[model samples]
Target: DQQVKQNSPSLSVQEGRISILNCDYTNSMFDYFLWYKKYPAEGPTFLISISSIKDKNEDGRFTVFLNKSAKHLSLHIVPSQPGDSAVYFCAAPYNNNDMRFGAGTRLTVKP
Candidate 1:
């Protein structure tokens, strides 16, 4: 069974607008949430992460909000720029070696 899911295959937003990406996980064992961004052929780069102990975490223009009760999490990018367009993946690790990744959501920031 898929532990993590990104229901929307893609999302589009105009420049300078807010872009929200949603993720859902079935595993309650996951205690940490991670977000990664990948450009075409490049490896996914870590964006931000949040611990289950915290409801929200933010870094600059990016923020991750976790709703433990709902088994849901979301990444919000404020004033999204064209350079921010990429495939964003939500991940959770149950242990050091076992990690679950949501099917990425392709974000298109139109200028």
Candidate 2:
């Protein structure tokens, strides 16, 4: 069974608009939730994270919200820029050792 999943495979928005990405996971042991952005042929770069103890975390234009009761999480980007177009992934540490990632969501910011 897949521990993490992104129901929406892709999303598009006009520049300067808000974009929301959703993620769900089956594992409850996951304590550290993170978002990463990736470009083709390059490794993912960490964007933001929220600890299980908190409901929300924000950095610049990016924010992450966690609903532990529902085993769901979301990433919100405000006033998204064209450069923000990329594959965004939700990840968490698995068994306190390896990291597990969801099937990424591709966000397209139209000019």
Candidate 3:
């Protein structure tokens, strides 16, 4: 059983448009949530995160919202740029930062 699921394998969007990525989880033990952005073969980098106790977290053009009651989370980017095109992953804290990740969501910020 997949403890976490990101239904869409990928997404594409134009530059300056908004990009949204969604994630869901079945594990109730998860307490911390994080979003990571990655490009090609490079390792993922932490973007934004939210705790189970909070509903939302934001940093500049990136924002993450957690709905614990529904075990759902999303990442939103406003006016995405061409440089923003990449795969994004949703992660949850477990076993000393052993984060469980979604397959990924690819955003194509076409210029």
Tens digit of lDDT per residue, candidate 1, span 1-111?
A: 889999999999999999999999998989999999999989999999999999999999999999999999999999899999999999999789988999999999999
**Which pairs clash in model 1?**
none
Angstrom error of the Cα, residue 107, model 1: value is 0.1
Clashes of each: 0, 0, 0
lDDT of each: 0.97, 0.94, 0.89
The model with the greater lDDT, 2 or 3, is: 2
TM-scores, each model vs. reference: 0.98, 0.97, 0.93
Best by TM-score: 1
TM-score between model 2 and native = 0.97
Model 3, residue 35: displacement in angstroms?
0.8
**Model 1 spans > 4 angstroms off:** none
Model 3 residue 50 CA deviation (Å) reads: 0.6
lDDT of 2 by residue, 1-109 (tens): 7899999999999999999999999999989988999998999998999999999998999989999999999999998999999999999899767999999999999
Return the candidate ranking by TM-score, descending. Answer: 1, 2, 3
Lowest summed lDDT over 10 consecutive residues: which window, candidate 1? Answer: 94-103
Measured with C-alpha atoms, the lDDT of residue 46 in candidate 1 is 96
